[model samples]
Target: MAKKVVATLKKEGGSAMFTKVVKMTKSGGNGSYAFEERIVSKDSAKDFFSK
Candidate 1:
């Protein structure tokens, strides 16, 4: 699954169309940070990390 995603993102124009976003978030119960990931449109990448 990871390989497929990486291959697809390498295609011409593919990167501009999509992106993989990862955000670090704190756990309310443990005070530990967890990583959150999502495949989102490139245009919305900033919005995804802002939250």
Candidate 2:
């Protein structure tokens, strides 16, 4: 089974950056999921970054 990350981004209150989370799938095992400085968005990149 392969494991993947599920994350989201939200406006950092008054910051000019975004908040995110890195989650692993139930079947993603553990070492299967690896990411760094990655961005996850529910909308388009432009829309996500625009906010």
Candidate 3:
């Protein structure tokens, strides 16, 4: 399976920031995907995607 990392944005204390990790891709592949809005943390999200 291809691996993918997604980071979601959220409004916290009147500031916009990454607040959660949406999903982690198991395998790596070049593909496109469409997603809605969600709060994803930056640290956890880095492993799946990029720094």
Candidate 4:
């Protein structure tokens, strides 16, 4: 399954410089979740959103 976007990290100028993605999984009959982060360089927010 595709990871769900949970939040975004930004620079001082209100630019999106990074992103946070999350996923949920089951382990040992219990529920758990994980997080992943990606870097979106300056002037690359558009490229990241276009995906």
Total backbone clashes of candidate 4, pairs 3 or more residues apart or in separate chains? 0
Candidate 2 stretches with Cα past 4 Å from truth are: 1-17, 28-51
Shift of residue 7 alpha carbon in model 1, Å:
7.5
Candidate ranking under lDDT, highest first, comes to: 1, 4, 3, 2
lDDT per residue as tens, model 2, 10-41: 23432224345443334356646544333544
Score every model by TM-score. 0.61, 0.21, 0.22, 0.26
User: Which stretch of 10 consecutive residues in model 4 shows the poorest summed lDDT?
Assistant: 1-10
User: Comparing 1 and 4 by TM-score, which wins?
Assistant: 1
Off by over 4 Å in 4: 1-36
How much lDDT does candidate 3 score?
0.43
Segments in model 3 whose C-alpha atoms lie over 4 Å from true places: 1-39
Against the unseen true structure, what C-alpha lDDT does each candidate score?
A: 0.87, 0.39, 0.43, 0.46
Model 1 agreement with the true structure over 1-51: per-residue lDDT tens digits: 999977888799887798778898899998999999999998899999787
For 1-51, candidate 3 gives per-residue lDDT tens digits of 122232221234322445544553444365655443355655555654452
Question: Which runs of model 1 end up more than 4 angstroms from their true locations?
Answer: 1-12
Per-residue alpha-carbon lDDT of candidate 4 for residues 1-51, written as tens digits (9 for 90 to 100): 122232222235444554333333446555665443465565665665565
Using TM-score as the yardstick, the better of models 3 and 4 is: 4
Alpha-carbon shift of residue 16 in model 3 (angstroms):
4.7
